[model samples]
Target: MATDDLVVPEAAGAQYRETMPSFAQERFWFLDGLVPGNAAHTLQQSYTIVGPLDVTALADALTAVVRRHDVLRSRYVPAEDEVRVQVDAPRPVDLPVLDLSTEP
Candidate 1:
């Protein structure tokens, strides 16, 4: 029934599952569902630049960071008994544009 966190197809070999979630990870995961849309545990910042940002470079940087850190590419999977981390290889991502330029 579980499809490797629904990211990897069941036909795509065996999914790699890491160890169980840490205390902090478990706590945060619980709070995430208990308080959806809460930003208390999140860190967000905005930047103002004078020129257009290289989206390609930004994507590459994000992918690189994910590749370098296995935790970033992992998610907790709950099953019949316990929860474990499922880590997958980094995939390419294309940034989406809002095109708010025309908005008044």
Candidate 2:
């Protein structure tokens, strides 16, 4: 068998409109179906900011990060046969700011 003889059915240009989900994603989809509204698989981080903090700048930075990463704005579609990951176009993200500095 030659390398040129091999062909991929899903191959379509440099960008992919939709692709099959990875193993991890498939597992997550199954888990989600088993138990909806479960946050066990979610990852979160917290940080304490000291002194003068620019909330607007922070929100802007976070939104920029979300826009840069396609996975951040992706949607997983589970079909009867398989699961697919669809990446949406880059768009501005809504970042809410909280003023917890006034707390005692």
Candidate 3:
């Protein structure tokens, strides 16, 4: 069975727009239905940098990187024949507050 057959078709009135997925991205798109999104198919890394933390700077740097790489902020749509990828310009992302200071 093809991946497209697994996904529900879009609405008739819905606007359809997307770019063709790269070869690498296409491989993953085909496996999307076969494999779970939460499952690990690639290497995983955990990082812990100890120092006077600069959250603001870290977030800013990440935002800049996102703006530079379209793939980082792109959306994917699977079609019967091919996979579609769309990218929109990056915008400011607000960080939510989480105070764990009281936790033991």
Candidate 4:
């Protein structure tokens, strides 16, 4: 989930509420090894950072990062509704960009 900002309130039970700095968060999920005749196990990773960012630059950087890392380009095939990892092409993908910015 990508959001412009995330505010966490301090002193929830107290009469006064203070809003702290917002953060940008990124989430990733990975599934590996099926259970004996069952579904595969999954691994999830999430990251949060606090600051202003250029979305386009960030996306480009993320693409470069993914390209640099072999895992992101890996593919998976479905087996009985469960996905199994497969070796895939290392080529970078041209993902469609969502226009979050309005024209000047």
Candidate 5:
């Protein structure tokens, strides 16, 4: 297939808006995979911070977030390395905690 044919559906446009809840009232976060020559593939996560949250709960919620979105759980097919979106068990993601209290 031609290089152009390898392009996946654009998930950052108006079409995606239709699939997302109102950002004003809901907390939505995006996770993207590293795909060369393509725009950042985003996965929308439904998240809420209730008082003080635990690390385990944070991990669980992040996993749940990936589970809730097909793109985040997808893997690239072999051969031509074509992108394929799928529904599967949640993959573990190591998220780094950053301290942003320091001024730049």
Candidate 6:
């Protein structure tokens, strides 16, 4: 039999509401100010596909994901004494595809 579906918890309130940064975000902001160009707070991910891939379709898929998720297009703006979260309008995601298939 199939296992029970995982229950995903939702945020307690409305979506895209104006709000200030959390403690962690505040700390990251301060640390970023102290150490510019630090990769400590950055997250990197990679995936490999062994079959034929459509570059345009992949870009469209990524753009669709950004359109559906507000956080993907969010930016931090400095306020009076703290930083505020600002959600930007979803736009086309510029995904550059490099053709390295000829490399041996």
> Predictions ranked by lDDT, top down?
6, 2, 1, 3, 5, 4
lDDT of 4 by residue, 1-104 (tens): 33223322434444322222112101111222322333333467887555665766766777788768645654444555434334333444465655544665
Q: Give the poorly placed runs of model 5, Cα more than 4 Å off.
A: 1-36, 40-56, 78-89
Off by over 4 Å in 3: 1-17, 36-38, 42-44, 49-51
Q: What's the true lDDT of residue 53 in model 2?
A: 80
> How displaced is residue 14 in candidate 3, in Å?
14
Comparing 2 and 5 on lDDT, the stronger one: 2
lDDT of 2 by residue, 7-93 (tens): 224455534346566678789988898899899989999987778987678778878898888678778887776777876655556
TM-scores of all predicted structures: 0.61, 0.63, 0.66, 0.34, 0.35, 0.64
Query: What TM-score does candidate 6 reach?
Result: 0.64
Shift of residue 50 alpha carbon in model 2, Å: 1.8
lDDT of 1 by residue, 1-104 (tens): 34334343334564554556667877887787789779998888997655778878988888788778878878788766556667766676557857565689
The candidate that wins on lDDT is 6
In candidate 5, residue 76 scores what lDDT?
A: 37
Q: How accurate is candidate 3 locally (lDDT)?
A: 0.68
Whole-model Cα lDDT of every candidate shown, in order? 0.70, 0.71, 0.68, 0.44, 0.46, 0.73
Residue runs of model 6 more than 4 Å from their true location after superposition: 1-19
Candidate 6 lDDT tens digits, 1-104: 22122212334653444455556877888888789779986899999999899889999999999999866876777888777776665679999778899999
Error of 2 at 41 (Å): 1.9
Clashing pairs in 4: none
Ranking by TM-score: 3, 6, 2, 1, 5, 4
- The predicted structure with the larger TM-score, 1 or 5, is 1
Report, for all candidates in order, the number of backbone clashes: 0, 0, 0, 0, 0, 0
